[model samples]
Target: MIQNSGIGRVLYETLLYLLDNGDEWILIGNPEFLKQLPGKRNTIVASHAPAFHPREFVGFPRRIINSADVFFTPNYNIPGGIRVPIVASILDLVYFDLPEIVRSPVGRWIRRYFARRAVRLSREIITISEFTRERIEYYLKPGVPIHVCYLGITRELRNQRADFLRGPRPYDFPYILYIGNVKRHKNLHVLLEAYLTARKNDFNCKLVIVGKMEGLRTRDAGIMREFAQLEKQGDIITSGYVPDNELYQLMAHTEVLIQPSLYEGFGLPPLEALYLGRPVVLSDIPIFREVYSDLPVTFFDPLSVRQLSAILENHSWETPTSIDTTLKSRELDYAAAAEKIYSVLKKYAG
Candidate 1:
């Protein structure tokens, strides 16, 4: 979903969430994407779809329309010509918001074109957050109703495990964890500078960056290069890429989970961290506040290293002032979301 990049964990997690609920669903997409679909009963994968431009879908393949009584694409658009009413999920419009870093101009323009068309073609649009829905309404201005269905965290992520088996941690002791991409908007330089300041002030903690360096454009590449140099200095542990099980282990063990992005659509990683009951430090941004209003966290300005450093210096793995998770662990219901999604799809199904 959304370029097959695991970096967009939300897409994959949404699919997994649906499958785990054991819906009678058949996924239709290019063959390569089949590898990423999670296994669960009553799910079928028809990997006959060949990758093609969305415009090419003016003569959209009929076999796809024949395969399902109704269509629901988690992170993609339905072809314009398909007669069946379809529902598609838009995680965010990062490409529209940050075109230079997110995609090449040609690619960005093409995706925007397809996104616009998808809004026109689909019966309904399911967006991850209210923020994304607002962005879609502002830019695409679709006639279709936009639904705000928050994503669900898997029980695997919420595993109850020990912080450490018992040790001094690694590379000079206890560490804070940062997961996800190092894209320009990620505001990583601030996190690095803050970690450095914390170290200077005798906060005996290493910074662990558990993500791969991405962004292929020239300026984005420079950001990656700088991160590589930071890795060389060994002030932080950049664990290139880790599996989910390992990532879960890391989250369970770290001193705090910090998401320093300047902007985010939903910030799924922090929510997952909070699901695991890990303390989180976030860049004080609207989306983060919107999502984590009740969850306990330390807030810092993404641009201010001093503020980030101060938050880190005082954060604890042990305890926090406020930890109300009713919004996440209980109230924000995924089963309700699934039922709502099914109700919409059923209205279109023959």
Candidate 2:
């Protein structure tokens, strides 16, 4: 698993829950990595293949798979030669929904083909949000049941400390936080423009972007120009990648957390911030509304830089003393999600 990714957190949380429940299992992954897991009873099959690799499609050990009553994966990609009933998770349809962001035509084709194939082959599908479930129904129109099991906060985020573990604050000055990468659909450029406009209006807080910025390339030239200028001018700071402890501090201390995504399966960062009693500004998209309408959050049109800038300048963002709503009563935690997922797997295993 890519340790810092949103989906990676989901996989880890679900696995932890499953292990705690003490079900005998056949796990597939790097042996070294699988050994680190808590469960001693699990049969780990060593497969060096990464997700979507050609080796994964054909190189999965048949004997190990055949022994299992059900074959389940957190992703849509299915391993070949599995005789058991399959239950797969289709997290999002972003690749099919937004083609312009997909640089490789062949990569897009591969994703579409495999996703469609997984829908056809799976006994049932699990998705994170109702918005994504509807998208699946509209685009793929699957024959099997599609279950909407909302994701939960990671263990790290849930058990966060009040003081910084690293012994110092990330930044001495106030900053607005953005957690995801600079993907085109993330609408980071609009955020940059809004930040610039906010600066002009005397909202002088810096912009701190928390993600890996090693190959920070965006197709939009205007975005690149604005980003370069702000970064050079010391108005924007990019923390390449920080561990969960440090990330909790960053999220905790920020003036506000903003997620200006044009599309998403479930926007986890802002939700994490909300859980911490921090104020959030999210894009006025269907998924954000579906997931966060009951929470204490502000929304703005994703495309309107002026409106966002104005909000940044004018809005009074107070960290709520208490968050009464339980994130729409969805049991937005891994235990519930894992229980629901386990029930589905067991149902199909019969």
Candidate 3:
């Protein structure tokens, strides 16, 4: 099990669930992140490979195949030359389908190369949503069994306790939340512009962006400066790399969770907010629509600040919607997701 990503957090929860239910597993990744895993029985093979970069996994195939029964790459990019049943989770084909949105040329090539290999070498494939399933079918060899096992929010986050004494509550007004790394595909500039417009029109609320600054290659730094200017004017709160507890607290108290990602395989934040009983304003993308079709979420165009502003200005907070608890109980639970993954593993292993 190679783990390193936002999705890796979901994988760790799933592995723990599997262990709790009497299935054993090993972890392969940076020792720092894997140290947070629950059980002590599992072995941790320290790997220096950076999660997103494929070059880091250059000679990893033999090492990976030698250790595990079935090799699973949770995010994407399977190590080459492996002699085992490689079970890969292809999160999204966004790199192949939307190359323009990708930050770097190397990132795009790495994704393109490994995605094809994942289809060829894997005995079974997994994806986060049905929308991605179709994309995989179109791009990869036909008839590969691609399972849609949705990612879940951790239970600890659901029952999180907010800190009353935490430093003046971060922002002045209760704000809509946007959580994730600030990447080009995240559409942060558009979100900032929309929030500014909404605030000007007596929306009277702030927008809180919680994530690390990324995408330096695509000149996202200029956009970050613009957001900083907005912050100076008191319309936004830019919390860079917050602790997990604080993130949960922020989600718990947020007026709404808005994710304007241009593309996604399966967005965990909106589902997480839904699980926390917070109102969600998401992009009108197909993946989000498929995952949250039945749920009552406000949708906006990720590319259009005006459309996003309209949704923000016109939202009603009084609707009694339990999307958060419902998703937590029905979809985002680790035990349930682990059961599905374990079942698939058993079927293939047999």
**Strongest candidate by TM-score:** 2
TM-score of each: 0.81, 0.93, 0.86
Ranking by TM-score: 2, 3, 1
Tens digits of per-residue lDDT for model 1, 263-303: 78788777666656678888888788888766777777788
The best-first sequence of candidates by lDDT reads 2, 3, 1
Decide which is better by lDDT, 1 or 2: 2
Q: Which pairs of residues collide in candidate 3?
A: 274-324, 275-324
lDDT values, one for every candidate: 0.68, 0.82, 0.72
Clashing pairs in 2: none
Residue 196 shift from truth in candidate 1, angstroms: 2.4
With candidate 2 superimposed using the best TM-score fit, by how many Å does residue 139's alpha carbon deviate from the native? 1.1
Could you list the CA RMSD of all candidates, in the order they appear? 4.2, 2.3, 3.5
lDDT (10s digit) by residue, model 2, range 257-338: 9999999999888877777677899999999999888777888999999989998999655445445358536677778888
**Worst lDDT window (10 residues) for model 1?**
160-169
lDDT of 3 by residue, 1-350 (tens): 33445766777777767656544556667778777767657676777766545555674636646556677667666766777577778878888777977667987887788788778888888887889999999888645688887877675664453332232454546788889876667777777777767877888777787887654233456656766787798677778777666777687678888888888888887876765567888888898888876787877777888888887787743343666566655565667777777777766452
Candidate 2, run of 10 with poorest lDDT: 158-167
**Which stretches of model 3 miss by more than 4 angstroms?**
1-5, 52-55, 61-64, 161-172, 214-226, 317-320, 328-330, 348-350
